[model samples]
Target: MTVEFAGEYFPIQPGGRFVVGREGDLSIDDNLFLHRHFLEIAESGGLWWLANIGARLQATVTDATGGVQAWLAPGARLPLVFATTSVVFSAGPTTYEFTIHSSEPTFRETRREREVEGDSTIGEVPLTLSQKQLLLALAEPLLRRDGTGMSAIPSSADAAARLGWTVTRFNRKLDNVCDKFDRIGVPGMRGGAGGSATNRRARLVEHVIASRLVAKADLTLLDVGETDPADAE
Candidate 1:
């Protein structure tokens, strides 16, 4: 197996364990949310698994269904069931993203093989200016702050206020943006009706940031001095 990080790839031998964290076999120092030994990947009984070793942090795992399957807290383990899986977590002041890949047979691999046989092409969807602005606001809470205090993820209302919109208006627009992404084949953007509102918002923010749909330069669009009359409460 092969593990890729920061444009570098490391080969993992079959049945050999690969440790990933700030001070593990794969040292990921870019994010402080990672522990000394945050995660371990290994093949056991002919199946690959990912285990979480962080004491406090939880890893969000998105399944083939494009919804969160589990929050892998300390002592938790999840099967690597897909050809590629996205893992996200927040710690301290930063959110981290990791992708796990497998060379063995998996649902995603089967789907890709079918696509290749059929010669299918996936197209990209363009974001409108308004959608771009909304994405920027949704991502603001995760961006680095300037003050000396401990970083905190902002509430939906706080993010709305930053964009000069009421929470209700912001949520309505957020739903619309999520629907747009869903129609465009973006994973993890669509939320189920059962989860807590806070979790849904967090998932949306994670998806937006992880997908690179929003960036620091896009924040400039949020600085528009005037608010839309329709967005005013």
Candidate 2:
């Protein structure tokens, strides 16, 4: 991940999987609330967690009638320390912000995008810089955040929030992604049974193309001249 501070973009290459923040349990008076510039996704499909990137959030609590107020600071991880079993999260534009108070405050943010390395089979196809950026941005959230596979169809709301688009706009961008995959002949990159095989193939092609191999037909990997591992026996 890259963080830009004072005109310098520093890459924070995690030695392991990246964890946005730490999580723990807490009592009712300690819930965290926040708001941000982008869209926020409230838990859907029986989920119990939520969070966002570069987001501004405020936390608080309320009584049974939903009348209460307590403001939380931005970018601080607050424990879900409360007794209100029901909590509400409001996700909208930065211009409008809201809050929810409850006895319990634990929310999980699901995946909404994915990342594909350069040097996959799909690396040979051509993609505009913007197209590539949007693709990675959308795919990473789905895989890393939501923890869904390539074949799992995620809700447009999730995609829209991550891409910073309206639901309608997100659907349009998604169509473009699909079309690009089709043009490149990358199968799972087009959204099929995604796994290491498909991901590797697509990423291989994509990497080659992005790096400008120039002669499409002449591109080939150095021969390792080894038997397939599965057949070594």
Candidate 3:
């Protein structure tokens, strides 16, 4: 079996194990938010498996049928039931894509029932246009880069100013938004002692992008007539 990501490839020997993370056996150095050893891929009994090794990060696994099989939370493991399985995840502001490949015929059979049945419930959280605008404002820094090559992440006050809102109102609305995500079981969207406000913002953006709750084209909703393209820079 082979694992490929970021123009790099790792081949797994039969009955061998591969660790993936910033400091794992198969180190992915570019993703700063990954745990030292986030995930493990092992070949056992002629079948390949992927396991999340107690990492706070979240992963999405899709089977060969192009249907989502599971969202691997920390310490979760699932079989890779396909000749080629795609895993999509994010570490902080950077998104990562990796693929696992195997020639074994055993991998073609789906053994587990899909666990994404709750996905339909995610859309039940009704969001107002103002709430969505705030989400887009918070996410803009990570999704788009500036010309000067500096991070575009704005302070809460700056983001509030961009939306013509006061800091107090902005923070109140943000809390409400986080509450909505919490009600629906989206990880990293709620504020707790686990991380700082900036970290929460990054994770929120990661989740929104990963779940397709927001998209680049949705930025148009933030625009008023006579908006300047340079402002997005």
> Against the true structure, whose TM-score is highest?
3
Candidate 1 lDDT over 8-58, as tens digits, reads 777788889999888877887756655888899988877888999779887
Which 10 successive residues of model 1 have the least lDDT summed?
Answer: 144-153
What lDDT does model 3 reach? 0.71
The clash number for model 2 is: 52
1-233, model 3: which lDDT tens digit per residue?
88887567888888889998888767766556778888899866656789998558878776545434468888888876678776767676555657788777454454875667454644366767777778888777655542111135577898889888889888888888888887877677767675468777766765665555666678887765324442322
Clashes of each: 0, 52, 0
Error of 1 at 184 (Å): 22
What does candidate 2's lDDT look like per residue over 133-155, in tens digits?
A: 34444344222322232333235
TM-score of each: 0.57, 0.25, 0.59
Error of 1 at 147 (Å): 19
What root-mean-square deviation over C-alphas does model 2 reach? Answer: 20.0
CA error at residue 113 for candidate 2, angstroms: 34
After superposition, candidate 2 runs with Cα above 4 Å error: 1-123, 141-154, 188-233
User: Which ranges of candidate 3 are over 4 A from the true structure?
Assistant: 1-4, 7-17, 23-25, 30-36, 45-47, 54-75, 82-123, 145-153, 187-196, 224-233
The collision pairs in model 3 are none
The positional error of residue 154 in candidate 3, measured at the CA in angstroms, is 3.1
